[model samples]
Target: MNRIELATLIFDRLVSEKEKLKTEFQNSDSGIGYFFLDDLLPNDIALQIHDAFPKTEQMVLKKSLREDKYVAAQMNLYNPLLEEIIYAFQDKRIVEVIGEICNIENPIPDDNLYAGGISMMGKKQFLNPHLDNSHDKDRNLWRVLNLLYYVTPNWEETNGGNLELWPNGLKNKQITIHSKFNRLAVMETHNNALHSVSPVTYNGYRRCVSNYYFSKSPLNDSDRFHVTSFRGRPENKLSDLILQLDTFLRMTLRKIFKKGIKENPHVYKKEKP
Candidate 1:
């Protein structure tokens, strides 16, 4: 099915849990305001999305101290199903409803898919605890929420690749959200939304469809423009220190260059035929 039909399904599922999700998010505001909904679409349809994922070789590999995963924002290079699902989350009706649920006003989806789109983590791949960049590609809008839809079938908690949220910072324990099949996790992104993905131990891929919602206002008054900052897991103190230094250098360059010495190549640039 196409984006419009798929968006209708997504909108219906979200509305079904509106009150429940709102309460879940509001109660978690003490830390990270977030909620996860399971079985977001019909079983068969979700499986179809799994089948449509591009091979890891076809996607861009982002490997460093910060993260190791395959990501694709150049949707035209992949299956049409991938593009449809990405834009389905951008559908105006769906966007408005999600904004309402998260208490955000005029939330906008990145059609350019800046640092947004699909990602997959294979064995040993992990995303270090980090805060996402505060704004959209142009530094114009504040990124307010992260929408992650996991499509890996029969993914288990023991298999790793789960999402971990550090509400109280690295000094404290994290809240792990299993990357279960057909689950959608929506979390507020701001100054303290530091999160990571557990390293995958299983010899399989944990695929996810991601999107971000942006707003004119920052989620918190204390929020400011910053690079996507990273930290090591609690056990790796040295790595944490190194990542801090990395963040410092990047932030310093941003101050001088404004948009960076070279434009970030992570954003999508639609090709005209």
Candidate 2:
């Protein structure tokens, strides 16, 4: 199916569950609101998305102390359906419905897909606990919501690669949200919204579709300009210290160069013919 048709299907599904989603988001713990829906699309369609993911070499491999995963923002380099599904979450109707559920006004989707797109992780790959970058590519707007759609089939929690929310910080146990097949997880992002993906133990890939919604105002009054901050798990003191320092240096540079020294290359530049 085409992008518009796919988007319409998703919009109708979300509309049917709007009230349930709103209640869940409002009552979530640790001051960070969120909601997840399983079987978001038909099983066949979701499986097709998983099957269409490109090989790891075709995507950007981000391997560091902070993360290990393959990401791709240049949609033209991969399957057209992948791009269609990614942007379907960005459809006006879908965005508007999400805004209403999260109780936000006038939320906007990032057309450039700054730091947003598709990602996949193989065995032993993980992302450390971290807060998302505060704003979009330009510093003008605050990133307020994160949308993650997991398409991998029959993914088991024991296989890891699940989403972990450290809402009360690393000291307390995290809330584990299984990255189940055909599930869509929407979470609020702010200064304190720290989250990460567990290491993948299974040999098979764990694939996901990602998007972020931005607003002119901050999600929380205390939210301030901060880079993507990382922290080691509670047991890893040494790594935590080093990551803290890493965040400081990046934050300092941003202070001096409001937009950073160079343009971040992780954006989709639509081809014009």
Candidate 3:
């Protein structure tokens, strides 16, 4: 089957296993929830999406304070079938199903796709541990969940580029989530769901399709506003101190300026009046 056929099949399966996947995600102790649909799409189909992806450029490469890695081209890039898959998740039925599993009500996706895009981690690229921005670009809705669809073929554990969840913080340890090909990992993103991507060691790249779902109200009352904060790994003490100061300085500016130095241009550019 092709990309369309494969995506349709996976969508159907997710709908079918909605209840079970929800239970597993909710019951997990790490304050994170995810499930894998193996061979979700054939290798050829997944590769096609990879091949169809446009080239890397300035507009998409989102660099971190550490300057090691960054996310690229987010807003449902121009591929026909990929766009279809993205919007399909927006269907009322599909949204409700995901909301049910997540135990949230009436979830709405962000109109401005912030921090959702294809992430490319090249050799030596690294993403410091951080919590995603608490709200969407406009601060209208609370960021409730993150949806990541990885399509990097033959990506292995040794490759060193994996999603790490630091539920307990850097002192305790982290749960490394593999960025396996054709695997979809959906997790709740909040103040406590601290996470990051380990540095990429391989010569090739690890590419992923990212999307996020937000709601009018936060999943928990304790949720509060924050930026995509970051910190170095446990071993990188000096890097950790610098990153901490970086977050503090930026956050302080936001506290006084209310909107920061300027509106972040990383989001989709809306038409001017």
TM-score of each: 0.98, 0.98, 0.88
lDDT of each: 0.94, 0.93, 0.73
Q: After superposition, how far is residue 227 of candidate 1 from its true place, in Å?
A: 0.5
lDDT-better candidate, 1 vs 2: 1
* Candidate 3 local Cα displacement, residue 61, angstroms: 2.6
Q: Which stretches of model 2 miss by more than 4 angstroms?
A: none
Q: Write the residue-wise lDDT of candidate 1 on 157-249 in tens digits.
A: 999999999999999999999999999999999999999999999999999999999999999999999989999999999999999999999
Give all candidate RMSDs, comma-separated.
0.9, 0.9, 2.8
Error of 2 at 191 (Å): 0.3
Task: Write down the TM-score for model 2.
Answer: 0.98
Better of 2 and 3 by TM-score: 2
Extract clashing residue pairs from model 1: none
Clashes of each: 0, 0, 1
Q: Can you list the residue pairs that collide in candidate 2?
A: none
